[model samples]
Target: MKKNILSALLVMAFGFANAQGTGSRFGIKAGVNFPNTSSDFHENENLIGYQVGIFSEIKTDERFGIQPELIYSTHKVENKFIKEGIAYNNDVKLSYLNLPILAKYFVTQGLSVQAGPQIGFLMKAEENGINITDHVKTIDLGLSFGLGYNFLQDCSVDLRYNLGLSNPIDFHVGDENYKIKNSLFSLVLGYKL
Candidate 1:
């Protein structure tokens, strides 16, 4: 994750060095996320979530742009298990402050491809009324890639995938080194101002 962030910074710095001029625009975006955890116990579960945010886009050219966003995202996981011939259900909810830096390449006037890295800070989590801060850390790192279509008026639809690079929680019973991987898929609506 550290390496990814460093790479993004280097890329952005290089872009800035070669940039002729800069144009700034602000926009609003909202999205739905389908979340899942990668672990032995919860591999079968799928969770639904969402995100809403504001972004600042700095254009470098007709074909390239950089967008930085601040987003509020909700994530979760649901598990169903059978105990003593009875079914039990459990849900875990997580909230995060997500920052993503995206590099975009426009394929046409209306379509573009984007890839980026996101850093998330965990804000809150609840698990059956037990405080689980010790089980989780506040920092999360993820990679995101997506495609978007923009209308002539600057409204757009986006589809993105966010894959976790680090575990947000330490779920192992006794091993501090053990962690669980999480991921999300989001469909977003965006508008430029």
Candidate 2:
């Protein structure tokens, strides 16, 4: 399944790369992520993470366009709690290769709204400096919606929220289940090339 997903992503990327027509542009982006998790086990505190990526925008017309990005992103969360008079602090960080293909609509010049599906392949998972990759799922599914502002002819800023649809945790104890999902908000700056 992982191989299939990787193949599909490659094909899609190549197809976009070959679309160097009149209204297409390519760019690089870097972002900060405010990462958190939804969980039944414990409350998670958001932590700062980061992402760097490449993107392509293909304008189909004056008002609409398609934008696809391949990014390396990190998500982090910290939890502190006391159980049975014992204090515990835990931090978890997960890294992924993320692909987001967005549909963009320009509401006005330099202002656009974007919505898309994102697929993330997990690269690493660590808890308090220990590798915990085996305990988590390897793929994540999400939806992204955001606003983008283009300025200075070749620069852009994007603010987006990623809503996670699948639980990344893979642990269950008999009839008990733990529900956990990852979510984050990103503030990104882009430069067209």
* lDDT per model vs. reference: 0.75, 0.86
lDDT tens readout by residue for model 1, 19-87:
435555678999898886775442347778889987766777899887777788987776565545656
Q: How high is the lDDT of residue 91 in model 1?
A: 66
Candidate 2's residue-wise lDDT over 1-193, tens digit each?
4794577578567856675756588899998998757876555687899999989888889999989898999988886655556676778899998888999999999999999999898889998999999888888999999999999999999999999999997555455576678888999999999
Deviation (Å) of 106 in candidate 1: 0.5
TM-score of 2: 0.90
Off by over 4 Å in 1: 1-21, 80-89, 129-131, 173-178
Worst 10 residues of 1 by lDDT: 171-180
Cα-based TM-score, every candidate: 0.79, 0.90
**TM-score winner:** 2
Global Cα lDDT for candidate 1: 0.75
